[model samples]
Target: MDSYICQFPGCFKQYKNRCNLKRHEEAFHTENKKFQCVHCKKILSSKQNLKEHEFIHTNQTPYVCREPGCGLRFRHGSQHSAHKRIHVAIKNIVNRSSVVSFKLSNIEEDIEEEINPKDMMDFTLPLIKRSQDYILPVI
Candidate 1:
């Protein structure tokens, strides 16, 4: 029985040739893994590796299409088609907002400015937060 080094850190498999590795990947690694190895021409066994492969093949991003009235942002035509169905043509009218009285006994009445919704979007997109932000910088 020969042992082959798994490019994935924690997988256990033994193979001596290309066909054996391919069989191992298909049988035990495909759907369970996050990414396929590019060198093996196999789908990754780790999500990390899949994402890394994407970066290497970034120029091959062929999936794209614009959704009507959606302002055009999606990775694939199917995604854009899905968006088009959801962002329907509906006329939205912003009627002057009427203030309702809610009595709060302990709060002061010093709040005078209205919160603009558009301003929120300006500040919000930057603060959407990403998983990468918390990753400690690799020195």
Candidate 2:
């Protein structure tokens, strides 16, 4: 069976059937968007794309981290899982530290110490600024 290749620039997606290829082209390459977001006036090709876009307007991030004092929320499951890994890494670092007593008082004091923003950026945590409006790309 011959595969149908997408003609879109920088997109080399291929499909086993012509119908699937057509769908992909309509979703990714076409200028006409059937689904429109009510809040941001963003246009999307499919219902699924519109649904995901709606989360940004609603500010509804259901996936929240369970760590104490860390109230980070994420819209996607993949992002949520990645944020959890940061907590795991911090926990491992604390465990391996020379502080053998592991008292709550010591941990609280350590956390209270002010760290520079540049130093915090070294950990590569997703620190989103809520003060600015995030613009979504139109399909």
Candidate 3:
């Protein structure tokens, strides 16, 4: 039988066939959905879902902001050109209904101000480091 390769980008692990991919997803990703979201405390069925869920943490919106008192928001600013608006006020921040937020201590600024790309970029990262050296296995 031809080797079944996991098609997910960066997942080089090959299986006996395509069925193995399903098994891998079930065992390592889907089976243990024990880790819960800290803010909304939602259950995650897989790492991909967990990663996507993190966008809520930053209140990211990829769609055109069309409501009144809105400018525009997109997962990528490139989509801004596709947006058409008539009556929305200039928006300083993108509004996402499901995002979780908390007040900053001793700061009068609105909590929305905390929705910063600098802070959010870290959470979106897949890995903290890429090292050529590998850790030695314990005896």
Candidate 4:
């Protein structure tokens, strides 16, 4: 029934309670950060914020695209969702036969570069055949 408003210039955001207004101010209006990252020493305001920041140091990519040839990795769900739009656009363009081939050629190259050869089940090393005489004994 009551509203607590932020008094900062140019920002008149209103909150339902005093506690929320204070948190909003501390998070945005001030540099009074409480949580410090152990890996990079970066300061954050809350535990959730610190946890999100820690992903950068850990190189964690929990959100993965399940598209057939893509398999791109992302740290956040929003990033994964945004990447899916590119695939959708590609599918829409595929109806146009001429542009489809040219665009897909470039996209396939980019996808190939992003994919790790070791992760592919079919990836293998080339074998060289040698005769018995060519195999010399080690000294």
User: Best by TM-score, which number?
Assistant: 4
Model 3, 1-139: lDDT tens digits are: 7887766667777776676577556545555665577778987765545655666797876556666666567653324544543332222122221121212232436555767768876776467566533222222
Off by over 4 Å in 2: 1-36, 45-49, 98-139
Q: lDDT by residue for model 2 over 3-108, one digit each (tens)?
A: 8999889999988789778867887889877999999788888776677679998888878898999988888655888899999987765554434444544776
Q: Candidate 1, TM-score vs. the true structure?
A: 0.22
Go through the candidates in order and give each one's C-alpha lDDT: 0.49, 0.76, 0.55, 0.78
Per-residue error for 61 in candidate 3, Å, reads 4.2
When 2 and 4 are scored with TM-score, the better candidate is: 4
- Global local distance difference test of model 2: 0.76
Model 1 residue 101 distance off true place after TM-score fit, in angstroms: 29
Off by over 4 Å in 3: 1-31, 61-139
Candidate 1 Cα outliers beyond 4 Å, as residue runs: 1-62, 65-71, 76-78, 89-139
User: After aligning candidate 1 to the native by TM-score, how far in Å is the CA of 25 from where it should be?
Assistant: 16
RMSD, model 3, all Cα superposed? 23.2
- Model 1 agreement with the true structure over 1-139: per-residue lDDT tens digits: 5566556558866566766576457546567654556555667664534554565556344344344444655544445666665545221111111111222212325543455667767774455565631222222
Best by lDDT: 4
User: How do all the candidates rank in terms of lDDT, highest first?
Assistant: 4, 2, 3, 1
TM-score of each: 0.22, 0.39, 0.24, 0.41
Which portions of model 4 miss their true places by more than 4 Å? Answer: 1-34, 45-48, 96-139
